[model samples]
Target: MPSEPNTYPGYRFPAEVIHHATWLYHLFRLSLRDIELILAERGVVVSHESIRRWCLRFGTDFAAKLRKRRPKPDDTWHMDEVYLKINGELFYLWRAVDQHGVVLDILVQERRNAAAAKRFFKCRLAGLKYEPRRIVTDGLRSYGVAQREVLPGVQHRTSRYLNNRAENSHRLTRRRERQMQRFKSPEQAQRFLSAHAMIYGHFRPRQHLITADQYRRSRNKAFRTWWQETCVPMLA
Candidate 1:
């Protein structure tokens, strides 16, 4: 078999460095500067600027690979929007998650109108490559319109509690945003959150719902599958 092509263009960091950078950014919840400091303590010197670029560039790539290695959720979807700060301005982040609490898609938009809702629906649905049997959302007219226009026949339900799954899904994102202080722009927020969602989806196990031993074993199996199907092939 042919060797997998490298992702870096014209410049390459060691594979170990790439792995460490990806792991620390997600696992330790460290910012780029913190990651730089942590690596420096281990005898690796890298600029924070480079670390930031790596997180933005390679982080997304790694997350994509991780997503491909995971099983797609066939359960119903819950969609919702939450207010977020970007450049001191309030923007909206449209998020969708499956019943299993797996993040399906996230889109950051300036408005919460029908047009914005349609865009979010298109982007999220396209990424998942599946039309869900049911979609639950809050009492938003725009959501109704978007559902009619895009999903058409898909079962659409509007209820306060029906959207709790999606509302709770946003909490992890809010926590990450707080850790970063705040995003400087909408583009930055979109890029970082999109990658963060996939990383969280990969490492997180249902600890509250499952035993610690089960969680550990599940996480290890997930990691091994991810490394084999994503890393060994894509980064070989």
Candidate 2:
């Protein structure tokens, strides 16, 4: 039998498997079964059930590691929500982005009302150490209420077209969701999407949807940093 591949420090599964699982979760938006099939094509013998177990066991810890390695978001934040389907039921996924279009955080909830919105702001938004100077969001009154309570003095804008930046950010998440055949539950959606948000924020080129020069430079730097820091192991 071939020798089993090694893993990262204190991890059980091969680091290659964990890395592949993480990439599959974000870039391709594949479920455990889909990831199993994909790896099988590459001659890695693994079961869908095993993939699921690996995700549940190590997914959150891997996400936490990525977050710890990421830089802080810009000072200005834009918030928005996109519709998500879970077990054929509808929900809203609240996402926040900084001025440069870097994703900051995401919250999955059943409602877009004041209560849900308040929880998003109070819980997810509050956790950020880099308190934004200004916040841009849609003309939702819930946002106003949350801002009044949580970020009282911060400048808040509620214009229609002004929030297009955030609205556009939702498209990427929507694309990823479609690939996964939708989430199974709100909890699953939240956990998976949070990891997605971090991965997206890390690798996305600046102004990718627009300018090329900036995109090229930003993408090169982002990938270079990721390769150096993530792919190469640090000395103990």
- Put down candidate 1 lDDT per residue, 1-236, tens digits, no spaces: 96554444544666557666876787666778888988899888889888777777677888888777778786689999999988778999999888877788899999999999999999977866678899999998999999999999899999999789899988888788889898889998888888888886788865787988899898887777656533444333
- The TM-scores of all predictions, comma-separated, are 0.87, 0.80
Which segments of model 1 are wrong by more than 4 Å?
A: 1-9, 127-129, 229-236
User: What tens digits encode model 2's per-residue C-alpha lDDT throughout 58-175?
Assistant: 5666656667767777778899988887888889999888887777788988899888888988776555665788999988899998888888989998887877878888888777
Q: What is the lDDT of candidate 1?
A: 0.82
Which has the greatest lDDT?
Answer: 1
Off by over 4 Å in 2: 1-5, 8-13, 29-34, 207-236
Global lDDT of each model? 0.82, 0.75
